[model samples]
Target: MSNESPLIQSMRTAVAAAPADVPLRLHLAELLLGEGLGEAAVAEAAVALQHAPGDAGARALMMRAMGLPTPADDKAEKAEKPEEPAAPGPSAGFDWAAAENEVAGAVPPRFVTPARAAGPGVGAPEAPLAADGSGDPGDATAWEVDTPGSVTLADVGGMQEIKERLEAAFLAPMRNPELGRLYGKSLRGGLLMYGPPGCGKTFIARAVAGELGASFMSVSINDVLDMWMGNSERNMHEVFETARRQAPCVLFLDEVDALGAKRSRMQHGGMRNTVNQLLTELDGVGGANEGVFVLAATNVPWDVDIALRRPGRLDRTLLVLPPDAPAREAILRYHLRDRPIESVDLGKLVKVTEDLSGADLAHVCESASERALLDSTRTGVVRMINMKDLLGAAKEVRPSTDPWFASARNVAMFANEGGMYDELLAYLKRKRKL
Candidate 1:
């Protein structure tokens, strides 16, 4: 359906095959700009710049795409000789700062300085900067921490068994410090929620944070890993330090498998060191992690490092499954709440979407609305979403959880070591997956 010429499409395919080829990518960007696709050209040029940050061709193309003057244009202007003896300002050596501002929209600056102005006072203090001319030291301005949200476990739709287990194994001790002290229960451990994708693991983590009246800071691999030597470990340590500073903070580690993958299987020494740093933080090496609560979620718990799950780490494991019947109905209702709908049979829809995850239920609602929109567009008559459209979408979209469970079936059957995957195995057996 694309109206692009065959040559452009072929170049795109070649660029995809060799994404690191900066020249080829620049050529594609030039072609896109010629076709009047300014936005698309900017995107291609930006990607080429990423591959080769110092490439002159990529920078020129990006400037052209953004309708800004390139370095060559600046050079030409300087060579023409000014009429009034070039002002006694900066030297004629390419004003890089001005050029950066010109293409600021297309390429963002790598670092930012706090913008401030001195007040008209005698003793006004100037803003501080780091030794390297960046922001102030110990400034965790990059990481975002959300205040305690209102989404408690009660707001969570269903999965009653999961709730009960969470309350007994995790929340009860933290909620009653006196009882925990009497019972010799240490409030120092973490919980690892493992399940198929899109099963609301991160949502449950946030809800737990809300229940504890704690701030939430979520960290993932991208937030921790750095290409520079020893920086990844430093980043990981900073994440925990920030959580400790904002005590009564829930440090939710999304996709923990990538951050703490099994060290034995890891091929990179940097990654292994990063995992070691994570272990050190969890153990509260330099400072006490008294008010910090750690909650991690992963689709593949088996891939996480063993050191991370040893006694005092993420010892407790919770299996999050797909939405049950009540959950499906709630999810359907929530998604349909704002949409124009007529006679949505929640009970029947729940029955049809038995094993669908929360995300799948959302997709069903979206697909049904899309169908109604398409019909209205074709017939030139507006219509509300009906049961027929909902049913048709449900029939068309197969359960995305199927493939996840298919792989989980083999793991549950063969790799339920230390009874870690007992909950998953039991669910698989009940579902006759084994």
Candidate 2:
């Protein structure tokens, strides 16, 4: 059967006219992925993938379009895309002029892998796919993902208090910047989300920007570091410079500790400076949008530099703890609301999910759905989750926090406050879990 569609033909024309520039090719591939045309997207990625065989960005785009789940095993990617080592000569002896000409004064670009964006619910850029599983230029290239501010506070589960506080700090000012000036402030705040991995910290970061109607720009730790030929450190600076220009913006830095860690702890002399460069940007530089809010997330907050946590810097740390019983119940309800669930005691299930995080809650729900579908064959109809299904599902899963509980508790106590939640200080005094 012919899998080629008309859209694929048009895509080829577009890609034919496409320039070989790295940035433009990336943007075009992203547009294709947004349209759900997988096969074609892979072909576009292959252009760069062929040239820069080791280029993380090119490979990530290709993998995404090809539905290549993960980076083609590191060794496999290298072996597949053979490289020709640079020739040795007078020019090869580390010529500064040659290096300068190669980069042409561009920011030392980092090869950003898409794994960073592969977290649950975060979609990659779009590419077109053919039925026969071939890479083609997409039939169509249109970006239709939920726009900025699409995720409201209501969409978020069980962070009412944090939402309320964040609204006062970020949303309120963003909504009324001029009015904010009347209050003798421009409404600039930095938020650091620390919690167990996969607990929607990154989602919350993106949602916050959308909720605030602020321009959202997400940067990774590796994006801030690259040993490329041009002005690498300056590239880090340019990223923020662009954000500053796009005021009323939210610059989200995920795994922030990777970039903002303490200089003294850094063994690399160059990164010690990179840390400084980042800190300077986080702080105000020439009155750029007091409306700017920097939201950063990290699983391990302890590794972050103390200076970055000072009152004037990335100080406002927000904890997105694992979903509690009520939150998990809510998370289950939120994710399962669209599906059919019969004979399930949500309240009872909530009680049993004492240790579940939001992400864990999602897995549980997915597990229930799969079980119902498989069980439906004999039952003669699609089934919904019940207590037995949920409980059984819960039993099969475990919290990531459990394995590190002992050491985590020790650090939590000595560093954050005697291993007890500050909010639950009074509760723990009467009945301590630690």
Candidate 3:
């Protein structure tokens, strides 16, 4: 009873007043140890250590109060004994007060937000990017499909204007920080990348992250859907939390309509609930503001929630379309950049690829290369792709946008006042190229 001095009593009183203040406890514990009150020191230090196991100073007080050697000396002694391992008990609980720098290494089967409950690292709850569409951690390593940076603007075919816009929006500002400040705009929040399928929507999203030196976290519709409403809300909150921590990062979403279909069309309670919850989490201040961006790609841009497209949410929408002739030619050079081509004229080839999308041209070039290299031990090699091989490939593969172009042409033709499809007049003129 005499061991309880006035100073120790004061320390206990202060700690009692703010029991949740882990930092204050550690400070009291360290002060007690400094004054040689080892017994009282150990008690305070032990309790403080419970809140934050990683604090080296608090840990040292515990060791001194327990009448044990310093941690360094103890580890050294243990190292001297080749046969014995240190009896370091299982880790105590983790302290989320210092929630920064905590990384959730791998995907968990299901995730719970760390704000309300302490759990292992979360893969970031914000933008779920699972392509197979399950969205959750079904497979152990099911987060992002392709690594960032691999798909450069050059890697993507066509969409040069879109590329130019992205370069100005994301790249130029990031690569030149001072210049960004001078221009008075920092890259933050959301950029909606919407386009047709296989037109490099996903590629451009990933490339933006890569070009900006940001981490990529993705989420899809399937990942956010929960049988229970409250669970989904919590999950959405957790995601934005994780995303802010992993700042200067891109949250890419593919086929976003699946997750953010027009709210008006949602028939089920689950769908509407999830969309509203998502809108709040993304558009609200509950999420981080600095360098945490959302890039959602969908074919059905018309179906995306309007709230998402409003000013601050997913404000910037870039329409990714099929490559025009010059773009198609660039795309051809890119896909065929590694492969060897015969004395076929690129200008002539470009002319023949009129009305074909970048994806369509890629398929044609790929088939041509495969056919050219099929005879030798060159499995999948393209040593000498000739004009005949390319023409043959054109016959084998069909244009993806043929039907769309036809409809567009008819619409433009009927709508035009002059006897011409004013908008598609250029494309109509190029019909002879194909």
RMSD each, Å: 17.0, 22.4, 25.1
lDDT by residue (tens digit), candidate 3, 1-434? 36666776787789999986888887787777677776666667656655664678876666666666896888999889789666765586556544433443432212122244456874332321211111112211224333344444554444557778887765676677677678876556677775445566665666677677777777776556678757766666666666666777777766777777787887887777777877876764643556777888876655677788777788776766666665665666656655766565566677787656666777887788657644221231214567788878877776786665555555555554333234244545656421
The top-ranked prediction according to TM-score is: 1
Global CA lDDT computed for model 1: 0.79
Q: In order, what lDDT does every prediction score?
A: 0.79, 0.63, 0.63
Residue 249, candidate 1: alpha-carbon lDDT: 86
TM-score winner, 1 or 2:
1
Using alpha carbons, what is the TM-score of model 1?
0.68
Identify the runs in model 2 with alpha carbons over 4 angstroms from their true place.
1-147, 168-180, 229-232, 337-340, 373-385, 403-405, 416-431
Stretches of model 1 off by over 4 angstroms after superposition? 1-142
How would you encode candidate 2's per-residue C-alpha lDDT over 1-434 as one tens digit per residue?
04545555565556568655665666667767777856556656666654554678876776666655555667687888879897767854777867778875554321122245455767533211111101111111111122355555555656666677777755676677678788866578777777666566766666677677766777776566778633546866887777777766777777888878877788977787777777787777776646678888887777888777776567666666566554565576666665666556666777777766666777787787667644643343434566677788888878765543445455666677333245433323443657
Where model 3 places Cα greater than 4 Å from the true spot, the runs are 1-159, 169-187, 226-235, 337-341, 369-384, 403-434
Q: Can you give the TM-score per candidate against the true fold? A: 0.68, 0.59, 0.54
Worst 10 residues of 1 by lDDT: 128-137
